[model samples]
Target: MSDDAQTPTPMPTPNDCDLPRRRSDFATFAEAIDYAARSEKGLNFHDMRGTLERVYPYSEMRADAMKAARQFAAMGIAKGDRVALVAETGAEFAALFCGCIYAGAWPVPLPLPTGFGGKEGYIEQLSVQLDSSDPKILIYPAEIAEMAGAAAERQGCEGQSWEDFSERPDPETDLPEADPQDICYLQYSSGSTRFPTGVAVTHEALLHNLYGHASGVNLGENDRVVSWLPWYHDMGLVGCFLSPIANQASVDYIRTEHFARRPLAWLDLISRNQGNTLSYSPTFGYDICARRISSQSNVAERLDLSRWRTAGNGADMIRPDVMQNFVNAFAGAGFRASAFTPSYGLAEATLAVTVMPPGEGIRVELVEEERLSGRPRDLSRPARYRAIVNCGRPLPGMEVEIRGEDDNPRGDHQIGKVWCRGKSVMHSYFRNEEATDDCLVANADGEVWLDTGDMGYMADGYLFIVGRAKDMIIINGKNHWPQDIEWAVEQLPGFNHGDIAAFSVETDNGEEAPAVLVHCRVSEPEERIKLRNQIADKVRGVTGMNCVVELVPPRSLPRTSSGKLSRAKAKKLYLSGEIQPLDLAA
Candidate 1:
């Protein structure tokens, strides 16, 4: 294991970064990089200790990518062939991704374990993706080469290091011509082992989203992106890496593992950068940063977030309290609440679906609980409300709709399944026609729409997500969003995200009832019972149903590759008797 396992190494920006403006005018990623090659500033890499590991300019990156393209051609890899890459936030991976584009092959960015899962776990996960992608070539960093090799061997695919992939000469023939409809890459949605749905995005769809994203955020001449998001994810790959190239702007990079150890390094990079900064993170990311720096004093003096024009929150439900905590903790350093840009998106739409316009900050709307659940408010009972923050309007080319069960659009404040239609929407789930037909629907006017599988409402054209529709618990015909239950239990003392998984469990009597799996740190029998009872009470109060709370050991719940708690996996594990409850008597 590397020392980065213990201590954080901060990645600093290079001196050569000239901070360019949005010079976007391209049809495909290959064209975008070819244009970027003319610029001095491009992708850069930094170590965990704030050191500039590599300053790979766009020109050099393009050259390196071409060399990789030659290697692919030499190996008889045809255009449109799948090439699996274990995405490591480095210049090498960036170049390889571009190389796939220039070579006319579809690059599949797979996740590299960052200590969340052990070696065997990572290999298991990698092998699944390898089989799904069915790539002829596999390239990974030296750090995880053994695991990568194991996965490759299992899949009967050839593997090599990034160095080996790029060390060869240029191909004899000219690079293949790329069309706007050519596939840029494959992004696997959550659930690798159980259900790997690889979304196939085209150059036209991706570029359209990038243009809409720039216009959606009102991107300016001086705006620059600073990110530590894993490239395997859409936000990290499309939003940070490809968008910067298409827009001709320079971006700073750091490994996600480094950011995990020292989240403050994220803000530090933002604070130190002189250009207008744009960054994004999930809700827990902000929560973790605030709590990590709580014990330190003079944070204001040490940090300079005044230039952070847009701090985006997405990839999960935006937590208002966590956002407020971040603002309160950093207000002394000139961080404003208005800097927050709450947005809603998923990989199926190729990243940006909706974005908060510049200067809107966040607007929390308190809708009646009944109205939220598609029921009229009962004047006879005290009306309850849920605080949902506005996720702004759809991007320029994207359309967001709140559709009810009948597949018709719902009115304002009526919660329903969220659907989207746009130029950026993916063509289909690669090689899975049945899954594609299930979600991708065509309208009467011949427009294709994507079923986001998310439950949310619309107010004044803004979207407010409640939770996943599949995760919603139904008891006695009324809809109970598991997010509400999990959130209510989160309000309990010492509880946090991933500590609880709420789902509907079938009873022996053939009735579906809400059940909660909570991680209990307290080993004392009495305290465990007390905690479980308290959780059940809180859940019952919010969900209007009695919940069976099962206490398990801490860190027992399953999480997705991106580190989001996987309720589906947890439910499967619990039902299979895999997650044994902590020994305790009733």
Candidate 2:
């Protein structure tokens, strides 16, 4: 490449984004890379400003990975030895991840700093995850070398920069052979990270999920991707990056940090890129994008989402209202409402369990509020409906069902815990037998099922997730979902998603009561009191319970590495007084 081409640029190039799809199946990630290397298409990494930093095609990536694997081997990385990588959105991370596969080492992806907290906070998060993985070595980007070193030292690991690791001499060594049962990596999603559970995903588990992803998305023609999801997360690691590589389809990426700064650029890349793009994000991503574009003039003429065929929503509950607003805002730019594909999955099931059939879009079922609360629908009471989005059928080779408290399958339209069985189910949590046993169990059919720990109901083979089982709040012997309260508070003016966190807090009587921690920018005490009261009124109106509304400063509430609201952590912090409320009442 020319010197200018080697460096990143702000300009969008039409020629580099589209690459022909090659293979759709692989025995392992290594085999997929081996196959995809013959193709000209690969991943393009973007900078914090959404500028294209580097274009790494498959052939060159394979060469780099092979050499990196040799370096890893020279450094005494053996088969099944875990190599922890501080995953950033870049070529180095991609190369090291694949190099681990080639070296037969399990790559444990760790999160990068999102500035939610300062250096110490990031170090704590990194050290905790590193300790859980217990890797001998940690590889990290040079930019965060100091923080990575501190975290590595805490975990008794030797830390090295990605630049230093890449420059190591390549030893001409025989590659370690891996079997289908051999581990691919240790997947640590947000839920996993907060709880410190490392899901042991084998090669077989990963490939099965990818194949199902290909089949579920109908990946024969016009399947390209543009994503800002972080690689440490499953949807980003397996779905956007690995799935596209295995299928030999082209993908473009912006850093997760960058997406948080400029979410519109994520859509801008899609609008400017020349291909049928398939991208996935949580409801917040689309909401943020719409909010950004709404303020811009000439939005319709400037943005083009016509070719965005699969606009997927996952990693959290799908918000139909936010999606509808997005469609209404972007329809002038040819964005279709049918492009919304709401799906559900967790790290334990590898990645995708169910995907909406292509072109079927967001299908919602309006169930009565009484029936949802596990009570008979009384005609005497006025009917209130909760619109649960259909998350579609299970992928090929996957079985999904809703099971009651007795552990038996529930009938259609009955709300209960979600259970899924498939080849993609994780083998176990690495070295945590007790934890693994709690979730993975076998039935008379000899099929192992993963208890998703999510409450949902099935209708005509589609899954409708209500809320996380652990996150459900019980007040006065009635169950309430945190999302309902959070969404309710968001409906009030001056609030949106991420602005508030709703959970259960113990009262003076030691009974559970509703609590909401809201992010407030209002400085005057009167406005703050007014806002807090407004939030409490709305929440009480919806939940039928008095709520303690505490107005906190912006960015005070905690979030997962993937930017999902961490109600569990938020509650812990609040109860411990770590999250001090702004003095709105005063």
Candidate 3:
């Protein structure tokens, strides 16, 4: 046979039916990995074009992790020490993260440089996180050595590429013993409206959340996962990475950057999977994929989505219209509407708070504008409503509550701050006692409840998120969600999601009013003026007040590391005159 014919076909690890599944029941993550290593399933890394490049079985990963643990011990990486690692979607990161747990060290997964930010911006971002995490050493892929090294040096931490670190002598050494209550890892909050804070999660909390997540999703023998979510985020780390090791399931992964470049390649990977697939993304992921296909394209000929059992939506607000557009775009290709699974969660909760039950799809309720705004209905005005998606019930060991400003529990259909109490909730914000106390409160029974700073209501036991509590704009004692204003502007011709940011600003008269910053693509001076007037009118129609409107250059709005608009940062930059708005006259 010729060389091409002689080469073997690449295959991913098998999801064996003979092996019994465990829902992260182990006391420690190290133990979980130890047990999972007995199985053949693990992570499969893919290229940008949806082609499998490496098949890393659990058995091999465990072996690599053991070596990494020995190396860490030789380097004096003791128990409870934080070791920061840039979360690249590959086998090296997987091995290093597991090795940290095996060595009894707490792994801190940091974000890679985002597309919008230059090297200096990324270094600054990394430096901030490094200062907060205070890791003993920073390990990253060699590609970003210069940038990562600069950040590490600025933070006064040791920095080395994983490639070089792996070459060090790793004599067999005894790893430190771990307890169920020992700190497992530090997850940075991915909030779009606030600075990232490291949330400390214990082994007990991590396992509890993972077990609840597996049960909530009804993880089965035949189910496989395909994903492109960044590992720095909780949903990708705890849900896709760590959960798979504990639950003994195989996965296929494409880098988040790769998915951004060619989003449909994610679906192409799902189509190639023979078994039932579980994939997830934020609402924008689906929106982008749908937008990539033209009305004239035959999706049925290019894709087969009938085997996709769970299409999870989380890590951002779930948009029902976006979900509908996806269904409309791919329904002919056997994509079932029932595959849409909406969920609610945060990093402070260790990951999942509520997961929609399998096969329910997206369920929405028509919440009136008055109810959402917490204002009396204006009877003279025609009733307007917003469709809020049901984010599903709490996990098995999780408890959900809606609390008002008085800290008293609210009844169903009353909007309030959403609170959850569970073993899965994060132990504390790392070394930030004041910030931790601000969110975690103790009740009469001495049970600590997490004050999830999200505004939502429960209806018939289903949670419906309204908006962020901090992002609420109160003008003249009336509450208005920034989403309402942004959505209103989006309805105007030629705008897209995340194209507008709305926040409260102090007016010239010393009164608080809503200000909108829009990303304008029109360059003509006259058209820019017209567009500004159009946006101002749209905002007035929605908020019932004249507001400040500024049209900015395209791609000027700040985004969080996870690619969500950072409204708080945008406001700060705009107020500081850093994010200059376009001069319509010029």
Top lDDT prediction, candidate number: 3
Q: RMSD for all candidates, in order, please.
A: 3.9, 2.6, 1.4
Clashing pairs for model 2 are none
Q: Which stretches of model 1 miss by more than 4 angstroms? A: 1-23, 114-117, 167-170, 191-195, 375-381
- Give the 10-residue window scoring lowest on summed lDDT in candidate 1: 8-17
Tell me the lDDT of model 1 at 141.
93
Q: Per-residue lDDT for 1-586 in model 2, tens only?
A: 7665654453332333344554446677788888888766788887766677788987888888888889989988899999999888888888888999999999999988876678998999889888888887999999999999999998898999998887789979999888889999998867832267889999988989999888888776555789999899899998898888888787889988788887888988888777888999988899988888887667788889999989989998888999998997899989999998888898899899999999999989887776666655656647767889999889999999899999999998889999999899999988888888898989998888899899999888888988888888877778777887888788788877788888888889887889999999889999998888898899877777788889999989888866789999999999999899998656
Q: What TM-scores do the predictions have?
A: 0.93, 0.95, 0.98
Q: Which model is ahead, 1 or 3, in terms of TM-score?
A: 3
Candidate 3 lDDT score relative to the true structure: 0.90
Ranking by TM-score: 3, 2, 1
lDDT of 3 by residue, 279-398 (tens): 988888999999897554779999999999999998777889889999999998899999998999998999999999999999999989888999999888888899899999899999
lDDT of each: 0.83, 0.85, 0.90
Q: What residue pairs clash in candidate 3, if any at all?
A: none
Better of 1 and 2 by TM-score: 2
